[model samples]
Target: MDKRGRRRTLSEHVILDAALALLAEGGADAVTVRGIAARVGVAPNAVYTYFPDKAAVVRGLAEHLLGRVNHDRFTDPSQPWRDRVRALALELRAELLAHPGSVHLMLGHPPDGPHTRAVRETLLATLADAGLGPADAADASYLVNVHILGSVAFEVAAPPGGPDVGTTRFRWGLDRLLDGLAAHVATGPPR
Candidate 1:
């Protein structure tokens, strides 16, 4: 309140929250400093105090979105590991599809943030449950990641705004790929 003028922390969180809300409501393009400020009941400059640009806010929102995935239904420990992995992938794909523009923000972003690291760690842990060793876990985790991202990209890019193949066909694709991938897992440490 002194030299800072505005309550920057509260303003930043508010702005980030507004940005996510905007993304949820109108996809990526809807998120702007002005839009966030309007939603947060603050001036645009207040939002600017937190984020230098729309892109920075979007990156922060992307990180927030990744954090949500870590706690979502897909990470259920009661579910079998393979089932959990598939469900998580499907859930994430669905979320991205539902949001649309977040798909692009997600795809090319660097995996350097905390939320991203948590998601990756969770994924790697799930892969280890599938009997992958440390090295195999890393490799297979990345492979499965690529599959999920690639699949989601197609889902987001599809003309129907979702996959035309449906869940059965889509899951079938995962099954065929996993069947081969699991062979490598089975050979590793033998469980």
Candidate 2:
């Protein structure tokens, strides 16, 4: 409602941006519908007009962040498949690290959104191209995704005493995982 007797206007993008800002400022707990509406200068119920509930808003924010991942770097065919996979992981890790407050909200969430789906597809395809069968590729992709999520969550939550030890650890862990995948491919899995 306004002086002109019109209801306050609120777009999905505006609501999502406000929610993301709240998430960046105070983690997932701060992105309530009421809070978003207030941030957008609308009545509390106005946010619901776009997002059904707070969970929906959180999902939107996570998807929004995932959508911003640099997929091009991972899809470049000129690079070795392993390097492509590693670039994807690093880019995703960098994004998650950039928003430490939002890591908790995103860590265990399903990758059903479009952007997350794209990343998943690319990862699986890369593994498949590197000689992994369908089952192996799917399994490996899931493991990689889980590793990135868990690793980033721990790095974000770690006590502020280390001088970026997580970076080395991440590279080491990633290389080990890739090595395991390479070995599996080389050994051709027992028939």
lDDT of 1 by residue, 4-49 (tens): 5666355556677787788878776788788888887777887777
Which regions of candidate 1 fall more than 4 Å away from where they truly are?
1-10, 24-26, 70-79, 161-163, 188-191
Residues forming the 10-long window of minimal summed lDDT in candidate 1: 4-13
Q: Which stretches of candidate 2 lie over 4 Å from their true place?
A: 1-8, 162-165, 189-191
5-110 per-residue lDDT for model 2 (tens digits): 7665679889979988888788777878888888988888877878787777778888888888968668766678899999899999898888776778775445
> What's the C-alpha lDDT at position 9 in model 1?
51
RMSD of each: 4.3, 2.3
Q: Relative to the unseen true structure, what is the C-alpha lDDT of residue 32 in candidate 2, on a scale of 0 to 100?
A: 84
Which of the numbered candidates is closest to the native, going by highest lDDT? 2
Cα RMSD for predicted model 2: 2.3
